[model samples]
Target: MMRRFLAILLAAAVLLPSCLRHRPGDSGEATQQKDTVLPLGFLTDAYQVDSSRVRDGETFSGLMNRLGMGARDAYTLVQRCDSIFDVRRMRAGNDVEAYYSADSSGRRLEYVVYHNDRIRSTVFQCRDSICGWVYSRPVQKVRKIADVTIHNSLWNDMIDAGASPLLIVDLADVYAWTVNFFGLQEGDRFRVVYNQTESDGEVIRIDGIDFALYNSGSFSASAIRFDQGDGGNKYWNEKGESMRKAFLKAPLQFTRISSRFTYHRKHPITGKVRPHTAVDYAAPTGTPVHSIGDGTVTLCGWDGSGGGNRIRIRHMNGYETCYMHLSKYASGIRQGSRVAQGQVIGYVGSTGHSTGPHLDFRVWKDGTPIDPLKMISPPSEPLRSENLDSLGKLYQAYLDTLSAR
Candidate 1:
């Protein structure tokens, strides 16, 4: 019985091996199953990305520069948008903003400029090459402006009007040549465009004038600086006419107009009316008197107390001017001495007449005394002809930009 069982087991093992061998070969081809293609869905279609918006007082170029724009891009933008801005003209308080895509490449830009509630300019830039907006800002919420009149000097009025001293200095520079602070008065007014930025806290100042309207008892003059191309900024009239008349009204800062030029003028000391041929300027002793125009001194002498000391000049225009009642003559100033307009020739004193210190001023034409106030002096030349075109263009451009803003 044991032998028969063993024989059966051996036969079964042999049969099992033959069956396994015939079943399959162990090749690696079973790993080749096909991969199913799944379609991709964009996340943008389901979700929007958050972005930042710019506010008023934000600069466009500054923000654009902070981005990755190269020099070429900036140059192109300025060139294409020259009518709006040159990239460098952006002010710190302008309204501007930028909209950037999630990836930060595509962008939309909007900008606006305002002077109080008055709109100066508006613009927009976008990936599609055009941009603009209805620039809205609550301007009426705050701000108060007033025209503060300044006379005799700019410093005090500017301070009283709550102007920055820095602005006062700037305003003085504009009217430096024409507005003599020494001769200012209590009636001069200044128009200043300023914002009450924070009530008593701070203010933003802009466009200030030293002599908006100067009423010097003898004459009324106002000066405004204007660009004339290569001639740069020169003072002119409100109608663009040059304020630089033939000559300034007075050579010295005289407080009062003394004796007028008259054929039969009386001598104050003599108590006898003589032919007073000049105007007297009453000022402190030793005050300097200037030559009225470019000329050579023809006389410098004393004539007792009635005339005191006097100096006469000969101008190329055949015109003559006389200065009298001088305390002393300027060094190097004598007969035949060449002098320019506003050059000091002498000082104020009670030398000639019985009155206090004063300057007796006179003008002559064809050797005849005339009203100095009525004399029309020639103006300094304007910009050279070569620069007129450039000046005109710059003026127009400035006006356009100024108007836009």
Candidate 2:
């Protein structure tokens, strides 16, 4: 009986290996194996995922609570991750995700992910211990070249060419001192080489412009971005001359000339003719008014009933600029305060002797009012002699790229 039992056990062990082997047409339990891959680097296939956008007046704690996270764990996460990432900075309209795992009591929150922007996110891990970490998606920088021709306006032409709207701001900044954007005519052309930043195949923003060429009528100009190795970067021409000037071409961007400077003109509000020395720029109320050049605030107050809210800045070489009919003054814009060129001093409004919202911009030379439109500003410093050659070579290379097609 012992020898018969041993023989049966040996035969059963040999057959068990063949029985466990899965075949192509087998309908056994082996086909039900679970996938082990994790999504978003945190949750596994077994967990359920839900996404939501942050609503108005909703806090991070409130969001976590709604996702089944306990109050104690939420508080612990907020407290511990304060230094690494501020939970309170989560903004409305941004996306958030919750991951849940099933237990004896049902599904429970395990992790929460907050999307900061296109390239950044924050994860709150709450499985075994309450902790959080901030992570960024990989970004790809692509070099692009564009050639645009104008038929109506620079803004419209650039937009029609499949370029980002942010590119217009960068182009304005590069040629602010030289080109007259408001006066761009038909047949004007622009060629540029720039960097576009993308994440997950979607464009986030235009990183910057490397080189640009603008031709309008017989006038032609080029701007090249060069780093000076001192944590400073500036735009320059092919001749190594800085593109910046002592004064900007306009105090505000994308505005029209409502009224030009004249010796005698009919007031829009009043019927009587008067000397309207300042140029009136018609813009919506709250349009920012910028300083034309670096200067100190000579005066910042309500100029009686005619001038409304006003700020006057005194610059070098007996130059002074005045911005009138402001809705309010910018923060810290007090008398004797130093301000830089393009700094916001006030906002446009229809206050004190105006028919509608507009900025009465005026400039003075030696206390005498001058036409703000006709005044020519000198350029800023040029590149050093030692750095000019290197910048010239780089500028030529960029120009070659622009001319490639």
Candidate 3:
């Protein structure tokens, strides 16, 4: 299961670009023509542009000197831009663009732009005195739809169908409460309608997913994004039920069960027949382990005998969960810490009484050990009736699209 999950993730990353090629309205034609001219920040057509990535050990002063600015001028420019845009804080591998005056003999610097991220940038302008200001780049959001069939796994199948790898994560999150990803079988499929954000013709991120439909063997599920007029948006089902459950289906993303809770089983290390009270999830060392539900950390330390670095979370209604064999705890994860569902609390490790790196996950109900796999958590409140009609129409429209495909 671990290998299959990883394969799905890896395939998504490898196949996203190809899958996107089939998206509607994504023609290969360039949006900007060769004759079309554009300004570089505050600089006009009279400047020559040079773009490069910040190199290791490169300093602002050194960059300015190489760009034909005198040492005194570089120092003065750095001083003026210190508060607005600290040149010292420039990071390696980020894009930097320098605009120089068109004159061949006296090629003076006009402006310098540093791209902080997809939407934010900092510009340093030179005139009588140098000054800097932060600005935003315009982003475009495009709506797209896809119908994907699961062959091996959802991640791999989506990639094969030319959808974004990030979309896989988002879709999984939407159905986290309703679906058991580990239980997904062959022939399962899903359809999704989502928006993709782009800047300068490059995909920046997935803006949001509007709707989704998942069909697993005999079971089918749907999720629709709706606004409740309370300044928050949530995913709800076709029947106006909230998709969020009290507890997540699993503690970690993309994992498989290595061992199950059983009685009279032979131990791997000791070779002694005993009752195993927990389920073990085999994963790579350092894989993030998340809290199964919202709770308070009651115990956050080592268990000397084979438990290794462990954490016990106490939940509402006499429920408790334990995560063992963690290599290290997440920051702010200590005794008495409050953790939300899906929050990373530790990482997979083989610290004590373990043959390999895996998570020994356990749960207790009313102080009695139970099968974590069989624990069924209740869903959150259903959508209010006042907004049901509008959401129902939206959900039907998405469902129609899925059926058409």
Q: Which candidate should be chosen as best, given lDDT against the real structure?
A: 2
**Predicted candidate 1 versus true structure: per-residue lDDT over 110-228, tens digit per residue:** 22222212333333333333322222221222333334566444666667776665555444444435565444568776543323333124433444442244454566554545556
Question: Which 10 residues in a row give candidate 1 its minimum summed lDDT?
Answer: 16-25
lDDT of each: 0.54, 0.80, 0.79
Q: Order of candidates by lDDT, top first? A: 2, 3, 1
- Per-residue lDDT, model 1, residue 158, is 69
Query: Given candidate 2, what's the lDDT at residue 211?
Result: 89
Candidate 2 Cα outliers beyond 4 Å, as residue runs: 1-39, 42-58, 66-70, 79-84, 97-111, 125-135, 230-233
- Ranking, TM-score, top scorer first: 2, 3, 1
C-alpha-based local distance difference test score of model 1? 0.54
The TM-score between candidate 3 and the true structure equals 0.73
Candidate maximizing TM-score: 2
**Number of clashes found in candidate 1:** 20
**TM-score for each model:** 0.47, 0.78, 0.73
Q: Model 1 TM-score?
A: 0.47
lDDT for each residue of candidate 2 in 1-405, tens digit (9 for 90 to 100): 776665444433322110122121234523442121222344245568898999999988898889888888889878877866786688999998887877798987877778888766777776565777665655679987777899877777887877766688889999888876766778999888899998657778898998899998888999989878665548989898889989988898988888988989987777789888988889999999999899999999989959999999999999999999999999999999999988988899988988899999999999999998888888778888899899989987887776567
